[model samples]
Target chain A: MTKPLSTEVDALSARHPGVIDRPLTQRFLPFAVAFVLIAYVFGSLASFDVVRVLSGTRTDLVNLFFLDSYAYKVHAVRKLESPEFVLSLEGSRYAVYDERPAWLAVTGEETDIDLGSDGRVHIKGDTLEYYPKDEEVAYKIKFGPGLVPQLVEGVAPDWMRASDIQVDMRPSLFARIWITKSKIEIHRYFLGWENFWFDFDSPLNGKSFGEIASLAVSGERMDPAMANWQYIFFQFWNNQEWQHGEVYYALLQTVIMALVGTLVAGIIALPLAFAAAANINPVGVARFGIRRFFDFLRGIDTLIWSLIFIRAFGLGPLSGIFAIFFTDTGALGKLFSEAIENADRKQAEGIQATGASSIQKYRFGIFPQIMPVFISQLLYYMESNTRSATVIGALGAGGIGLKLLETMRTRQDWENTAYIIALIILVVIIMDNMSGWLRRKLIEGSN
Target chain B: MSAQVTLTQNPRLREIGDAYERLSRSRSLYTVLLIVVCAVIIIGGFMVADEANSGSFWGGLSSFFDYPADIITGTYAAGWGWFALVWSYLPFLVETINIAVLSTIIGFALGALLSFVASRNLVRNKLIVFCMRRVMDICRAFPELVIALVLVLSLGPTPLAAVIAVAFHTIGALAKLFSEVNENADMKPVDGLKSVGATWGQQMRFGVLPQVLPNFLSYGLLRLEINVRASAILGFVGAGGLGAELKKVVDWNYAADISAIIVLLVAAVIGIDYLSGWARRALIGKTGTI
Candidate 1:
């Protein structure tokens, strides 16, 4: 009484026809896609030469980026001919210290360093000695002929690396000492950003937080003709090393660029969207032309637009705003037209029955229906354009992004780059949260 | 009809009418205030930007077409050589597309895994879901150029930097979107698989993935379109692609070359957009414009 499974399926397929006899293409489509994807992946891997890049990358630069971002190095440089030691951040003369810092003790020809658990470093004349905490022996680097520092005593520790010209002794992850006959440089690393609150030129540079707070509030004035708090505020805002005021202004400019760009784009697109909408435009040729125009606008990359604008407008946020506006108008126009096309026509018909003019009907019926979409889309673009503006700004339009590029170009200002990056992330996150919240409120209100 | 007429004439009706009028007046007042505030902000913002700019808007408007005009003339003069210029840029265009495609694939794979952990209903651990979401948010907050610029310094103008930058962004973006799709997936199959003693991974693989795969593919395709644009822009920062070529030409002030490169970029972008759009519709089994 039981038929074989294949014969029984055949019998069923004979009855149902197309239901059981699926096309070969239908069954093989997924496999075909998978095959193409896998082949492309392999082909790209070979063509991109990913292995060479991975091997060729300067790994130390990557490591330095992480180390340099949050921490700063204070270098104590002593010329071979002079006993006078110069202490400065990153060996920059502009940031030199007028008074001795607490970490180093100089007593005549000898000096002592408190390197924490890595033990003490004793510098006497041309000899640098690193005394390990557990070992009785000390590693000594002697500055010999031609100012070349050579390891002269004891087994060299793993942390100390020597070359023909200099010896680099890294006591800890953050601390390093470089010695040559020409100069002896001690780089002490500290956590947290230096000169963030006040640069070295400020009178309040080495003051404690409580002291600074008191200076801000108390009757004692740091400068004449200004209140103590005002002077403190001015000092902090205009800190030469940080440029906080300019950065904040640039950030504001970037945000304003996004806001203006989106708002103007939306304002212009709402009308053009009508011209492209199927129900409203009706005329096939005109609608097609408008639609293709939108595509043309959208097709040209914002980078190209900003570059062109930069040429005409010189270098500034105006170019950035124009670029964002031009690109977003095309995008918003397309979306708005789609929303218009999908809008329910029954309300418009009702308005027509009330003897309303076409414009009045669009305003009373269609506009209200699409208001939520328009608002939400504008807000969304505003957030995204904030990001785009940053990029455009990096491409020469003036903003925080331009400042970021400037710092990055310095090669040694990695800390400043990190600071700008952190600020960018903070502002972007804030915009995202604000846009989401506003979108919810606006959508609910529209309904 | 008599009752309706009496109701309209009642004191209570008048009170209701008065309240309604007050509400409507306040509402209209708010609307007008909002419109005025928006107008002022836009205008004020524009003025501030204009002041900060090197060239005034009105001053620049007259010269706006000067650059374009020059580019057009140059391109016209190049004649058939323009085709060669565009053709020469194809390899860089291919490099740009490769970065987008590879990053998309890698990001999709990583994002699929992260999305599972990030999904609230799928993952029972509240801390994991919270942490993963924040991680994704942080990753997404970073612009690709920021990462690419940093990497270019270390990697020396290689496409690998752009790839990693775009991939990092794609992972975060796709994870967020994929988790949203996961949230909408039917829970019954997962429950059924669990009751049959399936492990979490197996359950997710058999139950949840099948439900959300089509949408995942659709979003992945859409992300590919975005990444193409992103990678091209990343190339401008010395990450090596079509943008690098564009930047080179721009820096040299090669008008015809710039025009040709722009043409190629536009064509590639629009072509990819169409291809991805078509693929997405096919994958999702939907016809109307998104």
Candidate 2:
């Protein structure tokens, strides 16, 4: 999109009606050629594989997807010294397993009974010991019997491995490994979508596929059917707890990289912009050299610069920042110099007639005219750089992209990948708003 | 009179002189930026120097620049490998081309419709234009990668999903441009068509569209080239393209392959660039500017 200039179609057309020159052939030949080539390519796809393009990708996906690539370390809880028993999982209460403590000497129902902290309740007929201390870590038990067999039968790639299971009320960044006698079975599904992997670990390996699968499946709803306008509102009307957190650290890294990079580059670019401008250097050769210098540096894409930086500095956030800074310097210099070139000559002339020096003329005349454009350009650069940082980070320069890459490629965490995307969108909105605000301020301030 | 003529006649001399004086005046700003640029160039120089120092890399690299020296002159058949390379790039190229072509077409098609809504002379509702523009703005604000990710989440990771995402952006950008073109178009034909009881669609069909079609085509061709580049980029988000292949090589640290891929990519870019230029020139005819 371009800023509209004052040239009117009315006046031009008024002078001539068929002014567009009716020669469609000369003007549309290339478009026709392009169209033909594109058509040919698509038409030929049925017969072609081109080394079966994206085959390795599919193989990689197959390898990484599902539970075959996963391992778990879990300890069975019932085998340990604890009284936490599984409950009816379908939001119900089943038969209670009770025991009387050995030292209690006596036990009774007080309606609201608090079995002493250090004591265990012993059942009259059963040998099971009910430790109230352990019972406080209550877990939902299931009445249903067949959860695992159903899942394994449902999908061949699907597997249910139950291991060390701690029943921590809260979840951590990664699914935690079990400790001591607590056992956990993870319901991990690997899907091709965003390299998706989800794990539902619990203290109980509830009876069948339905009981466990219900817990896992019921968490997040990603069905495409929900995207329809009629259904979209219904789906989000009650935002599930599964809608993961945004504004994580990786996003912050990307934002910081863009801001710090462009600003640093701007600070470094102001002088070069002046030198490159045709107005500044009287010697044509020197001016030409400065101009070419800016071009040569900027011609290299930002991502390539990032790759180079990574190689030079080794893998880290530092390399990413350096890449952004280096590329922005050259690019911003070119933009700033162009702004300078397009400044009003009259203002500079006015300064010249006053017997002002070179620096004085630029300070008084050039700066005032070009500052607004400079800020506008700066705003654009900052906006563009946010996305660039994500790309560079994917190359292992450390950012949200690194998180995204690892999860997708190795961990196969599609849901988390979705969460990462949401975070990126949020940042983009924030950046857009910030750019708009800054542009308005710079324009108003200059005015 | 003579001094005035000299000043006017030698605009170049006056421009440079004035520029020099201005530079001298803004010494601090210019000096600082100068130092930064010099440092950047130095760093870039260092990278080149470092590359040169790698004996094998330089040797291979130097050999690469030799024009057709190792062309398979004999009856040596590199058929399958060559086929593999072409195949590897084929779908990617197709996807990229598809993204470019479809995006431009959809953008151009919908842009015309938006321009109709946005024309002040044709439509007087400021609120509608504002809402429409804002919607377009939001669409354009998103990078294609972000769009691909979101679509992959909502719609699944199909090529159709990618096409939709990119097309969404193209619609936004093209709509805005289309509105501008419509706004600047002559109102005489539109007024006459309206006076004759022509509907809004008819007026647009005959009155305004003819005036802006050439410019629209030119912009669309330019957008096509951009889409090709963008399609390549969407590979980073699993949208599927040449970028995915390039990414694999980079991740594997296959430096030779990386270099070759980049060369291919840049060559593709240049090819697209020239093709777009030809298209633009064709659209513009002998005009000085599009």
| DockQ leader | 1
After superposition, the stretches of candidate 1 with alpha carbons farther than 4 Å from their true spots are: A1-32, A134-136, A144-150, A157-164, B1-8, B285-289
Candidate 2 regions with alpha-carbon error over 4 angstroms:
A1-247, A282-292, A406-415, B1-108, B111-134, B147-165, B177-189, B210-229, B236-241, B267-290
Looking at model 1 chain A, report the run of 10 residues with the lowest lDDT sum.
A141-150
Chain B alone, candidate 1, TM-score of 0.93
Report lDDT (CA) for all predictions: 0.87, 0.57
Per residue, candidate 1 scores C-alpha lDDT tens digits across A1-447 of 565799899999999877777788886897998899889888887787878877888888877888889888888888878877888888887888888877789998899986666677898877889886777998888884476788889877788888777788886777778787688877777888998998788888888999988878885666888999888889889989888899999998898889988899899999999999999988999999988988888889789889888888889998888988888888899999989998999999999999999999999989998998898889888887788788888998889889889999988878888989999999999999999898998789757
Residue by residue across A79-165, what tens digits does model 2's lDDT show? 223333332111123321234323224334211112333223232211222232543432222211121111111111111233233
Q: Supply the TM-score of chain A against the true chain A for every candidate structure.
A: 0.91, 0.54
Predicted structure with the largest TM-score when compared to the true one: 1
lDDT of 2 at A62: 44
